[model samples]
Target: MTASHELRLITLYAICARLFFITLIVSASLLPPFDSSHKTILPAADPRSLFDVFVGSLLRWDEFYFADASRNGYQYEHEWAFFPGPSWARRLVRSVWSTGGRRTISSLSEALFTGALTNCLTVWSARILYLISVECTGSASVARISALLSLLPSSPAVIFHVGYTEPLFNLCSYMGMLNCMNAKWAQASFYFMLANSFRSNGVLLAGFFLWGLIADPFLRKQKIPLLNCLKSILYAAITIAPFVYHQFTAWVTFCQDDGLSVEWCKRFPPLIYSHVQATYWNVGFLRYWTPSQIPNFLICSPPLLLLFWSSTDVISRLFRSHTQSGLAKQASMVLPHMVPHAIHAFVLTSWILVAAHTQIILRLASSMPFLYWSAARLILEQPKLGAWWVGWSVTWGCISSILWAVFLPPA
Candidate 1:
């Protein structure tokens, strides 16, 4: 089959695979002792009907927070921890079908709609990921593998079709990366802004943009005027303006509480979000270190190791290679490309190492496309083991989804 045909087939297969996995999670939720009492946010009581079991099963840990916050607005202090992006996006989406302009909807229905929207976004993300991999590696098979692995039973996969920010975040950030790969700086900046609105890590894309300008020979050769360069920098700052605006919102909220004086409020950086994260969730670099969190740390270590290993290997080649021809030259050319991946992986891994909830690394790591790219490369190098790799990946993904559905550990 032609490459385009192959890509289409893979896209179809990914959609089917996602559907099958979601069905399994729904089935698992209907089994014995299927309790919904443990849910923190979504309205799940006894699954008196099939609808309750299916809808209730999907609203796990963070979904409740998003759903409740979207439906009610940030009513409590802890609610401030969530970025306004996903919650507002969910409401905006739900409003499209509303008879009038109403954004409010029942919590359960909102959860279901948001979950479905997330799944759709994930499918689109897989398509973009496939295109990026093909563009970068010139190997359609590797690109296919990368896209498939992204949808495999990774923790992020569980959130792919759930009511979470990842699907939207992935779509926007991957789009930004794709634009960067094409050297469309302006378009990339737009998507990067959308991404930052969804998650704080969206700011990381700024590094990607800077690296492209510095490393890409074609960009450098253009030797654009200084005024245009400054304009580009100004646009990039504008893209991140939403985040700066949110900090102002947080500061205003803090000031209204009256616990802090006006002088301190003016002096303090937007400590509201950081305070909530540290106090309510025990989140900070290395602040969560304890013997109890060892299992989570261990569970998340493999991906971390793979990312860092790939990054180190690439960096070593860039530094140590002396040859100016053939494979060494090709590696040297790719070295600049690897710069973004190394930086992204290191910063994310550092967050996990310093933070208490290492389990979150599974979800947060979804934004780092290099991880999937590395997995695809490994599969390509071991062609004979590809089948086994796919099997293990899909099976593990299903197991993880089941665990998530049942509200089990290591979510």
Candidate 2:
């Protein structure tokens, strides 16, 4: 790397390190006392809390399982209801603690490990954004801008501190993308599958991987033979099989218990329309509520609205350029690669719309690392102004996130 590139990497790493420390502090503050109330600090109970509950229940599975069943039926176990595949991993984690009467230490250690995993993932996601920006723009400065923007306080606060799957899912998504770019189909498929296991929408990475494969220039020179194609297909299937099996099991269980169809549409109706209306209402102008909630609303709305506008502008520009560029040209280039990202944004938006839940924002924030790079590349032809705009936006976003973290209620 050149001197400038090294400098950019160092600067971005420093910013990420700062954000990581901040996230750790915030997350530590939010940890519940060992014997305090069962209620969580955050507005909605998320995977983190559920993970904690699962660990606690492992100490007395029979009693806790039946009690939870009596109280909330299957709903109480919904979060831990991973399919047969992850059950072994869960058991292994439990086994580590069951060896000694160190349950408390085990629980705390689990929480800390999860938090650290999330922090590392967010940092890796930022690094991927930096790499993509450097590739697209061929400028160390632009890459640094993308990396710094991704490390802005909002993204880290949401991912590391908020106790969501966003960080892990984002890391896996980017790993899949990176492996695909390097033509490592098997590794790409594995990370993509892991991402899917983390979150339902993570299958989007497969679309990204396919786009990367089709767009690769090497494929033109060395024609994809039948064996290669078969290998790729097998890799993709192996990556997807676990998630499919998990879904199938869930569907069977739902049908057996509820006596109803278990189609994806029935399970999640809004998936059909891309959940556009719901996405808009939840994260857009409609997010503002009554005066009592205005402070919280104001704190959350700016980054969300900015992200919405940025995504909209991207879509609008694509549509406007379609006729001039031609569908085939665009499809083989940036457009198709970007489609998976757009789908990710849409899915995240839909979740926000339906749930109006706070943690969802952090989940969607994972996509911003990629989106920010795209935004920088799109506008950076104007160099000076583009740099200023990106810098200012990042500065404001960081300030907003810090203030929000300082003042906002726990979780």
Q: Kindly list the per-residue Cα lDDT of model 2 for residues 1-411, writing each as its tens digit.
A: 784565557556845664655544444434443332223222233436645433331122122332233233445224333223223333445566567765633334544444455556666677676665565445677667667656654443433433345565666777776676567888888887877765555555555544445433232344655666566567667666666765554455554654354333364531311233233334334353445655554555544654566556555555655556643354212443454455456556555644554434643555545456544554555567556545655554555344333333323
**For model 1, how big is the CA root-mean-square deviation?**
3.5
Give the candidate number with the greatest TM-score: 1
lDDT of 1 at 205: 75
Give the per-residue Cα lDDT of candidate 1 at 192.
86
Candidate 1 lDDT, tens digit per residue, 1-411?
587786687679779977887788888777653445534444446666777777777777777777777777888888877888977797786677585875556666677777787788888888888887777766677777788788773454578878788888888888888888888888989988888888876766777755666434333345655655665576568567667766678777668778466443555474666777777888877876788777777777667676777767665665555333322354522444555677777777776677647767777777777778777666766565555646656666777778877777566
Number of the predicted model whose lDDT against the real structure is largest: 1
- Deviation from native of the Cα of residue 372 in model 1, angstroms: 1.1
Q: Which ten-residue region of model 2 has the weakest summed lDDT?
A: 57-66
Q: After superposition, which runs of candidate 2 have C-alpha atoms over 4 Å from their true positions?
A: 1-105, 156-158, 161-163, 213-242, 252-254, 257-359, 374-411
Q: What is the lDDT of residue 153 in candidate 2?
A: 41
Worst 10 residues of 1 by lDDT: 324-333
